[model samples]
Target: SQKIEQNSEALNIQEGKTATLTCNYTNYSPAYLQWYRQDPGRGPVFLLLIRENEKEKRKERLKVTFDTTLKQSLFHITASQPADSATYLCALFSGGYQKVTFGIGTKLQVIP
Candidate 1:
């Protein structure tokens, strides 16, 4: 059984600081991993994707690192602002027609 775990608690941080979040998994052999952001009452939007062979991936103000050996991923948001407040989700794509599974998400709250 594949399982993904993230912080179920909300992260409260001061604006302009970096926010770090962790994602962990069990029993899954994913071909790729993806990160997504979700605002209130809306579906998640894709952020970054890292293949099994890739060590890291990044976008503006965001960086993600994957450690397949440990079955974990870390997400970082630098200079985070109030506008960056949202729930961050981690998903795994296992390939071969298997449906992807997403973590419950960790809510980030950047205080202004």
Candidate 2:
């Protein structure tokens, strides 16, 4: 079975610094990976997506990297502010049927 894992604890960072979050997977080959941000009591909003064949992707202040060989993905937010603080999730399709699996998500808190 395919499984996704993210940091179980919340991360605290000072405002204006770069914040990095990690996602790891096992037992599956994914065609693409996606990142999302979820606020308390709210649904997740899409942030970025990276294809398996792509080494890196970027959008404005956000960046994502996918390393198929390492079975890991890294998400980064530059010049992070309090508004960037949220629970970040990683998701991907697995198996022949393309079932989607999401990581547990890692919470981030940007302090002023």
Candidate 3:
């Protein structure tokens, strides 16, 4: 069985700093790891994604890493702002597997 777990239930960071979030999996590695931001009463929005073969990926102020060996993925947001606060989720998709697994999500709060 494959499962995804966020490092923490909540993460607090000061604005203007980098906020790092962790997502760990067990049993099997996913072919792709996707990051999403979800706000209260709103559906999750896609942030960034990384393929199993890619070590790292970046989009604007967001960056993501996929490490199959550790069965983990990391998501980072640079120059964090209060508006960046949201519950972040990690989704896993396998190449031959039809099922998709999603993390419970970690709530990030950027304080001024």
Candidate 4:
């Protein structure tokens, strides 16, 4: 069985700093990896996606890296602000009818 894991605890950081989050998986090779941001009582909003062959991807202040060999992905937010605080999730897809696996998510809190 395939499994995805993220930090189970909340991460706290000062405003205007960079925040780095990690995602790890095992037992399967995913063709596409996606990251999302979820706020309390709301569904997740997509942030970024990286293909298995891609080494790194970026959009504005956000960046994502995928390492198929390690079955891991890293999400980064530069110059993060308090508004950036939310639960970040990582989803893995193998490109079939199989269900997408999502990590439990890691909560982030940015202090001013």
Candidate 5:
């Protein structure tokens, strides 16, 4: 079955700590994958992306890694704060980016 999935329902982390989220997909050879952060009432905001040729990508406190063999991607946030709490989604673009699929999204709660 071709499906994308996030780690779990919700992730709870303490302030100043690091939060790691996982995204796994099967039976899809996507050219690249993207991550987005979505707030309660707002649309998802682009976070980061990793190409099939790249092993990892990082921006500020956020890091994303792509593993084509395992068909998995990992998202990390360092120095997490309560203000960073949101639902994170992973999208897969395949067939020349014509087809796209999304995970169920994982909610992150950074407790102060």
Candidate 6:
């Protein structure tokens, strides 16, 4: 069976520190990987998308690395702030037409 796991516990951190999160999976031939940010009771907003052929991709203040060999991906937020607190999710596009299955989101809490 295919599965994805992120830290179920909330991450508590001080402002200005880097927040790192992990996504691990097994028994999946994922077509693409995506990351999203979600606030309380809100739908996930897409942040980054990486196809299986890509190794890494980044945006302002955000970086994502995909390692197909290890069946894992790493998401990092640099210079984290209290406003950056939110749940982060990793999803895999599987099956035909890119059906997405999401990992349980990881909550991040940043202190001022």
- Give the Cα error of residue 77 in candidate 5, in Å: 0.1
lDDT of 4 by residue, 1-112 (tens): 7789899899999999999999999997888899999999999999999998999999999999999888889999999999999999999998573778899999999999
Residue 101 shift from truth in candidate 4, angstroms: 1.0
For model 5, the stretches where C-alpha displacement exceeds 4 angstroms are: none
lDDT of each: 0.94, 0.93, 0.90, 0.93, 0.93, 0.92
- How far is 50's C-alpha from truth in model 1 (Å)? 0.6
Candidate 6 lDDT over 20-101, as tens digits, reads: 9999999998888999999998999999998888988999999999899999999999999999999999999977644889
Backbone clashes for every candidate come to 0, 0, 0, 0, 0, 0
Candidate 3: residue pairs that collide: none
Model 3: lDDT of residue 47:
89
- Give model 2 RMSD, 1 decimal: 1.3
Q: Given candidate 2, what's the lDDT at residue 5? A: 88
Ten contiguous residues minimizing lDDT sum, candidate 1: 92-101
Q: State which candidate has the highest lDDT.
A: 1
1-112 per-residue lDDT for model 2 (tens digits)? 7688899799999999999999999997998999999999999999898989999999999999999999999999999999998999999875553677899999999999
TM values, all candidates = 0.96, 0.95, 0.94, 0.95, 0.96, 0.95
Q: Clashes in model 1: which pairs? A: none
Q: Candidate 4: worst 10 consecutive residues by lDDT?
A: 92-101
> In candidate 1, how many Å is residue 27 off?
0.4
Overall local distance difference test of candidate 6: 0.92
Model 6 bad stretches (over 4 Å):
none
Worst 10 residues of 6 by lDDT: 91-100
Q: Clashing residue pairs, candidate 5?
A: none
Residues forming the 10-long window of minimal summed lDDT in candidate 5: 1-10
